[model samples]
Target: MNMALLPSMVAIPLGIAFFTYLLARKSSILADILGNLATFSILVISILLIKTRGVYVIGGWNPPIGINWVLDGLSNLVLVVVALISFAATIFSTRYMEQYTARYKYYSLFLLMVGGMNGVILTGDLFNLFVFLEVASVASYALVAFGCNHEELEASFKYLVLSSIGSTLVLFGVAFVYGATGYLNMASIGGIMATGNQNTILTVAAVLFIVGFCIKAALVPFHPWLPDAHPSAPAPISAMLSGVLIKALGVYALFRILFNVIGLNQLYGTLLIVLGLLSMTVGVFLAVGQWDFKRLLAYHSISQMGYVILGVGLGGYILATGGSSSVAALAILGGIFHLANHAVFKSLLFLSSGSIEYSTGTRQLKEMGGLISIMPVTRTTCSIASLSIAGVPPFNGFWSKLLIVIAAIQAGFHAVAGITILVSFITLISFLKVLRYAFLGELPEKLKNIKESPALMGVAQAILALFCIGMGLLLLPGPREFLLEPAVNALIQGVEYARIVLSGS
Candidate 1:
């Protein structure tokens, strides 16, 4: 296939989703097969795109004048993440969702969500990014409500209202950017911004983008909806939301715009640090008190994501202030590497929660006991994920947290480093509670008959668990060169991204 055929990766899933909707009532088996195939094909295409880097212009027109889909280190990395997780989720859903009705509708919305995320990552235009973001958001809202219980409905409505406000703000930001620069293409706007001085209107747009993306990412102050929404959704959907959706729509877009387009500065950098610190402190503290398993995990999502933003924001601060490039590079590398690792371990945690729910029919941590005896696989995988998230040595989280701490100390921010270490310990304490209450105690008589999840769910959890253990190798010499380095280079290059895109053949 031609490399430019990459757009077909999104198109095929979308088309299949619509077709599945039409045929879903008659033959759900067809929908299942097609959904899996579509996701698999996208994964293959994403791998192919990783091998070649360039822009794919829609309808044969150049960027800044026409819609463009750019594929570089950053987009390709997110694409791979989306494809891999979506594929696994689809496989797990095939058997897991058998208890639910309207299987075809479920697959259709799932593919739409996948397609929207792919579009968000690939688009090189601001308006197009918003459009795709809505596609994903709409699908996610509906999926959260798929069960349609009172709690799910309430959570979905809350999510819908908050998310709509965020989207409206994002649209307002897009309008301001268009009015300021007279361009919609990210590269074009970036080129213009680099040559000109900043102004009030652009500042307002930046604030709007930050508010909108923070809500999407569920940062501390804006995180009220996430706890309700994430825990109420089906396990696979919860995994997808926590694993990739927020990263793709919030952190990735925010960095692309702030660093690569609007041009990062001291003000924005400090703002990110403050927000990150707040999310870290508040999220973990609240998480420690939650008895609902998935709800607790959702809060930690905010906490861990704070680490990512803090690292990246600190990098931007160094780059903006003309500080040491090596220090800045270390901070960004830690952030990006943590982003990838969190996706794996967090998704595994959610899947493990789902496995428990499937076998036991409840998510309240205190109500369960001695699960390890009856559900050994779930216990083992869940323990590994908890260790990874708590920053235990040799697991993925420790390396990334260590990098961030070292980078913070190197940058003369001893307080930030201290806080990071403290938060890691707090995370460890919280997971210990989870292990004790949910997995480690004496097997309650009511739970004695619980079994391991079906083969597909176990396979999904195992794959993520293996990645969690092996993820430390990414910081090693060879793999670092192949995977993490290019992504770090993309952000560090900043506005030079415009030159790369414009100069590509």
Candidate 2:
């Protein structure tokens, strides 16, 4: 629980990443072993720090001056989610990456992305967050094009151009924040902004931050690149991009700054709601028509993220307008809970998609049939994931979506609540198309000899599948307090985050 261990969350992965690339260049097995071990280590550290909170000031220099890493309820939650998905992806990649030439290169980039995400989660300063964002972003750009095929290269190029614009906007936001408050540390700037001091520069910075993160998160209207990138990359990378990368570098960063640093206002809250509604409606409507398997999931990723944004936006609006604190807390809780739930189920879905393509050599749903007979393990796991994402009962997704609905209704947003349910229904219908075409009906002659995915791939899917089934238990009082309440309390603290960071307690 030592706060000092916080740095290791970022350090271990970065160190292992370079070591893996160098030492395992000729040995894919060594790369696989090193990659899994690194992610598993970070996962363990994340769990141990679940009950811990403090700041690690670098080189004995105090904050407002020194660069620091923070361990708190919110950061801990994100770190755990990132570590969990990274670990699963590494395990899945052992067999999955054999389709590629240099497996070690994949692991190296993969761990670098993991390290960058961890840094983004743990950093207490805006500049460092931007730095880590680039680390992750640049690595992802290369990864999308790793296959060296025309399709992969084109997708990676488009992703690169759009993502570069986002990064530039984020950098400009950072510069503006520093110019406005003369501090790069988040808690420091937040403390200054908490007072009645207001200025036009900060407002512009806020706008830039919103747009930048919207692009990174692949929210609607700003989500041109994800459809191509997710389907082009290797499946494990696809899972990472949808499951945790966007959350860590996009939604989580945006909200932390809006709620904690700039201090949410009625205007900002309304903007978030509008964006959320747009993303939810547009993403799903487009998704329901997709025949390419991973492409469908990619669009769904945009829609599902809208649920997170809507829940949190509703809560932020309530707080900004001086509505009931309890209702706001519930709404935010639903957002964060769904954030965690999506990490598990969506990752399972993408990994499951990988399993199918690995066996059958195609991603088109109409080209697959009666996979249930040839690939029982994949069918069961994929079915569980599909059900979870569609908000079916007893799955993690159902509980979180239900909480968002109840919270929306309680907050007097009946229209919003109705739309939420409607979207879930639409989501269900889309997945039904997947199940009907891919798992049921007549067995396609080309797929008759296809087998279930390799055992390691199945194990990876099973790990996330168990989480999908059991994560609803997170709503229990004890677990909620242990895992979620602390995060809520952290965001609820708002400007008080400065005092905690400055005190290093």
Candidate 3:
């Protein structure tokens, strides 16, 4: 547990963000170097900290009295995911972003978003979490509208309005929480509540938190903004938003506060399961009918995220009902494992879509054809991503989805298991449409001269694609013990998390 290294995770990207904007304003190349350097540095640090855990107090102050950053298993996992996706995004942007202006501004906002996510992950208190969430949200809104076109502006504005509403709800939730417990530190609040001292204000705050994060996660009824925002953003930004942003800010925050802070109950767990089912069914249905490339992928992001929520929600329900701990652990393992898996394949899919659009200048399926013969790297990588997302054998998605299904049945969630399989089948059908229309048909006459994407873009896609294939290896005994199990234990520990944090271990 190296406490000093925890601050570096948040500080490096934040410090470099302004420096990149100021010093590289005139040089896109310099901006590229700085952005990649920052993300890469964090990625390396994240891997190093995987075996490390501790609390880093700010300004030599102690817990409940001073602001702190805690690096436990859960935060470390998210930090690694954030750093990895941000690094790959920066790499992909070096070549793909040539079409956009003010490259330094783009990198600046990108790092700011990364920094905010790190802050959200590392913060030991609820107030700082909200602040970081807003930082990341604001940056993402600007990036979505970075193109400044009518569609981009319109989408960004809608994202802004809806996301602002969500944030306000969260602020109100925080206020109610503070009023009830008189503490902003999550462990302090959890400690007080753990003595069976729950009340109405806390309950209201819980509902508010759930609704706010559901909107941020874009679950079904709260998901109208994502279809527009994701398609309108540039490819790398889209990858970041779909891959890690929603998970870090929405799903991870929601579950952490519920399971660790206020405490999970049967009612909340059932509500989560309901939301997961609706998002899975509705999102995939809508996606299946879309002919636009990025739009379809956007809808599937909602559906895939539902898988994660379902798995974890099932585990929470089991725990709340006094079910077997081993079964609950299995359920949570599936959920968090899927979280990591989705970040890899979905990011790869978006990058592949970007490569196709870069060379073909179109996002409509009708406008694409026979890419396999020309864009070999894009084709192979996209095919691998497509198979993974569809939950085909030997790819990462299958194992996670399988784990969820087995956990559902083992927990007597037969209906939930059925819906999970149905949604996956529909997901496969939708992606197959992408493959048949976008890659397998005769090459459009307009695309004959189109070349493969640049070396950096391919490198980025290849990096994630390899993960899409290899992530299943994490399910094995050693990696699962070191990586996935710690995260599951963190969530399952519930109020014990407060004890650990308060003890500074």
lDDT of 1 by residue, 1-505 (tens): 4566787878988998998898767777787898888888998888877766788888888878888888877787888888888887887788778778898899999999999999999898999999999999999999999998999999999999998998999999999999998999999988887786577899999999999999999998999999999999899999999999999988889988998888898999999988888998899999999999999999999999999999999899988889999999999999888898888899999999998999998899988988877787888889999999999999999999999999999999999999999999999999999999987878778887778788888887888889899989988998788678888888999888888887762
Worst 10 residues of 1 by lDDT: 1-10
lDDT (0 to 1) per candidate: 0.89, 0.92, 0.92
Model 1: how far is 44 from its true place, Å?
1.9
Native-to-model Cα distance after best TM-score fit, residue 156 in candidate 2, in Å = 0.6
Model 2 TM-score is 0.99
lDDT of 3 by residue, 366-462 (tens): 8998988889999999999999988998999999999999999999999999999999999999988899998898998878898988999999999
Cα RMSD, model 2: 0.8
Which portions of model 2 miss their true places by more than 4 Å? none
lDDT of 1: 0.89
Number of colliding residue pairs in each model: 0, 0, 0
